[model samples]
Target: MIKVAVILTGVLLLAAYLVLLERKLLGRFQARIGPNRAGIFGLLQPVSDGIKLLTKEDVIPQGAHRRIFLFAPAVVAATALLTFAVVPMGPDLHLGGRKIPMVVTDMNVGLLYVFAMASLSVYGVVLGGWASDSKYAMLGSIRGAAQMISYELALGLSIVPVVMLAGSLSLVDIVDAQAGRPFILVQPLAFVIFFLSAMAESKRIPFDLPEAEAELGSGYHTEYSGMRFGMFFLGEYVQMQVLGALTAVFFLGGWRGPFLPAPLWLLVKIVLVVTAMIWIRATLPRFRYDQLMGLGWKFLIPAALINIVITGFVMVGI
Candidate 1:
């Protein structure tokens, strides 16, 4: 219980700062100043943002379903935080004559659990949009659901090769399986597929058709106000960190490196993945809705299937 609390607090704090980091990086990418006024180099920017969100007036539309509208944000924030429970931050540490695993929980079906929680997050978006009683919100939510469902297949299939190699669904086992070398070298295709699918799943750029502000007027959370809206924002950034962690665990070799500590290595890998994601956001244009669906269903899904079949045969041959 203590471990769970600590991890939850840590993840929330990290999520808050990640928002600031993204803003700063995006500003630099766009050749403009970021949030440098909040504190030295915008160190206190996230704190300021939090206060503003919390202090803002909470408004509910006249026709909105008040109960579900209020509940929806909780679903997003909760599921995003829950997915981190099985993620291993480092190897086991010996303390007081007992070994303590770095993860909050070590489940045999950790990977499945992560994906399950990810799928549940769509409900929050859908419900928030529907309950708002707004056409734009409804359309955005529908797009979010379809996009998530489409990319989710590719996301699951992309990791099959890793599961095959690791011989276990446990994330810790997956990390351990990479003791000698990371999976990226052997399963580069899976890495690319997983990364792209994950970006879509997180509802970020190039795949952010659901939240295309120019078209949908802020999308699913169009009617959300104050910290209620902030919850969705928080969930997105936290999910981004979760994706970074998963990419590190599955491909970059979670918490495994020489000279440096295991946790630090894992952190380094996550930062690299997150930075790449940010760069993509800065460089690429958003895909049209049809283009987004086509890429996921036509290209990524089939590619992942082929990768899995090839991996299976190679394993059988070996």
Candidate 2:
């Protein structure tokens, strides 16, 4: 219980600051200053943002389904946080003659648990859009559901090679399997597929068709206000953090590096991955809807399948 509480609080706080960090980095990428007035270098910007959201009027559209509208945001935020419960942050620690694993839970099917939570998040987006009774929101929700479902295939397939190599579904076991060297070196193609699918799953950058501002007026959350809208916003950043951690664990060898504490090494790898994401966001233009679907179905899916076949053959022969 105590461990869960600590991790929950820490993740929430990290989600808030991640927004500030992205804004700062995006500003740098665009050659402009980001938020700096809220606190030194905008260090306290998230605090101010939180206060503003909390104080804002909570409004609901008259035609909206009040119950579902209110429930949607909570679903997104809760699922995003819950997905981290099984993520192993570092190797077990020996304390008081006992070993303590650095995770909220150590389920054998941790990877499946993560994917299941991810699948559920789409319902939040769909409900929020449908409950609003707004055409734009409905369209956004449809796009979101379709896009996520399409990319999820690629995402899951991309990880098959890693699971094959590690011979376990538990994230801790997967990390341990990489102790000699990270999976990125052995499964570069799978890593690329996973990274790209992860970006799409998080609804970032080129894959952000669901929330395209020019097309959908902020997409599924168009009718949300105050902290309700804040929950959706918070969910996105938290999901990004989750992806970064997963990438670190699966490809970068979570918490495994020389000359540094395991947790710190994990943190460093996460930051590097997040930075790359930010850079990609700055460089790429959003994909057209058809283009997005085509890439997922035609390119990423086939590539992942072929990679898996080759990996299986090689492993079998070896």
Candidate 3:
């Protein structure tokens, strides 16, 4: 219970600050200033933003399905937080002759658990859009549903080689398999597929068709307000961090570094991955819907499948 509380608190705080980090980075990318008024260098901007959201009016559209509308954002936030339960941050602590694993629950099927959570998160968008009773919201949700489902195939397939190499679905086991060397070295293609698929899974930048402001008017959560809206906002950032951590676990040698503590190494890897994500956002325009779907279905999926076959053949030969 203590571990769960600590993890949740840490995730929320990190997610809040990540927004600030993205803004700061984006400001630099665009040659402008980010939030600089709330505190020293806008360090406290997230706090103020949190306060404002908490104090603001929680408004539901008149025609909205009150129950589903109210519940949707929580779905998004909760799933993202729950994903951390199985993510091992470092080596287990040995205290008072007792072993405490770094992860909340080191399930044998942790990878499957992660995908289940990702699948569940889609419901939040679907429910929010459907309950809002707005055409734009519905369209956005439909797009999100299609996009997520399409990319999820590639996302799952991309990791097949890793699973084959590691011979386990457990993330901890996968990390252990990479002790001699990171998977990125041997499975660059899978890493690329996973990286691109993860970006799409997180609905970042080029894959952000669902929330295309010009087309969808704030997308699935168009009718949300106050902390309800904040929940959805928080979910996106948390998912970003989760995906970053997964990337680290799968390819970057989770927590393994020469001079840093294990946890710090993991954190550094995650931040690097996240920074690249933000940079991609700054540089790439959103993909057209057809183009997005085509890439996921036609390209990433087939590539992942072929990579898996090649990996299988190599393993057999060895």
Candidate 4:
């Protein structure tokens, strides 16, 4: 238990650095310098940000539900880290004469665990908006709920093909089976669908309708401040990292590469995916809520279904 706790702490710390990396990368994407003013090349920006948020004054809205407001951010942050417990960071490694799996849990129903965690995470959004006692928060929360639910269905259908091909739900097994060939080649369409949907599920770019600044004023988190807001901020970036890692694991072939150790391969794949996400954010304009919904249900979901059908047919013939 202590070991699990320690590893989790390390993962959270890594997530913090990831947010800083995203900002710096975004700066490079936009042809501008980023946070090098903070510390040596801004390596310490996340640490500075963490300290600022923690020491800032806590603010509750005039009529906000104080207890619910306080609890919502914590819930989101906790759930985001929990999903990583099942992700295989590397092949099994020997530690002190006992082998420890890189992942925290090796469930037969690993994919299902991800879906379940996603579903439960909605409470954080719903609570955050309701507890804020503000119209903007409510609207943002509603947008978040609708967006997540719509994208998740497509995300699930898309990945079903990979699971079908591998004949297993264990993440580690899926990676091992993709030793030479990545799932991206077998299901490129599904790969596109999953990547886009995961972005929506994480409330990132084109799909970040909930946080659309022009319309929502910081969205569902408008009323949160201090560590309450910090938790949500951390949760968002961690969610991004988790989603990027999932893209690598299920499609890009987790921890599989030539001339690189398993952990390095996994990290390299995840960083590329994360950079692509940054590129998308830098290049694409935010989608209207209606347009976002239409793309997910009218396009992505059906496309994923078709991909699954084709995959099923191919596997049967083989």
Clashes of 2: 0
lDDT of 4: 0.88
TM-scores of all predicted structures: 0.98, 0.98, 0.99, 0.96
Report the poorest 10 consecutive residues by lDDT, candidate 2. 263-272
RMSD of 4: 1.5
- Residues 29-141 of candidate 2: C-alpha lDDT, one tens digit per residue: 99989999997878999999999999999999999999999999999999989988998888888999999999889999999999999999999999999999999999999
Please give, for residues 210-272, the per-residue lDDT of candidate 1 as tens digits.
889999999999999999999999999888889999999999999999999987887788778
Model 3, span 75-96: residue lDDT tens: 9999999999988889889999
lDDT of 1 at 85: 92
Give lDDT per model, in order: 0.94, 0.93, 0.93, 0.88
Q: Candidate 2 deviates by what RMSD?
A: 0.9
lDDT of 4 by residue, 1-318 (tens): 765786677668777888888888888988989899787999888889999999999988889998999899988988888888788888887979999888888899998998888887888998999999999999999999999888999999999999998889999988987987999998899899999999899988878898898999999998888988999998887788788789989998898888998877887887788778888988899998889999999999999999889999989999
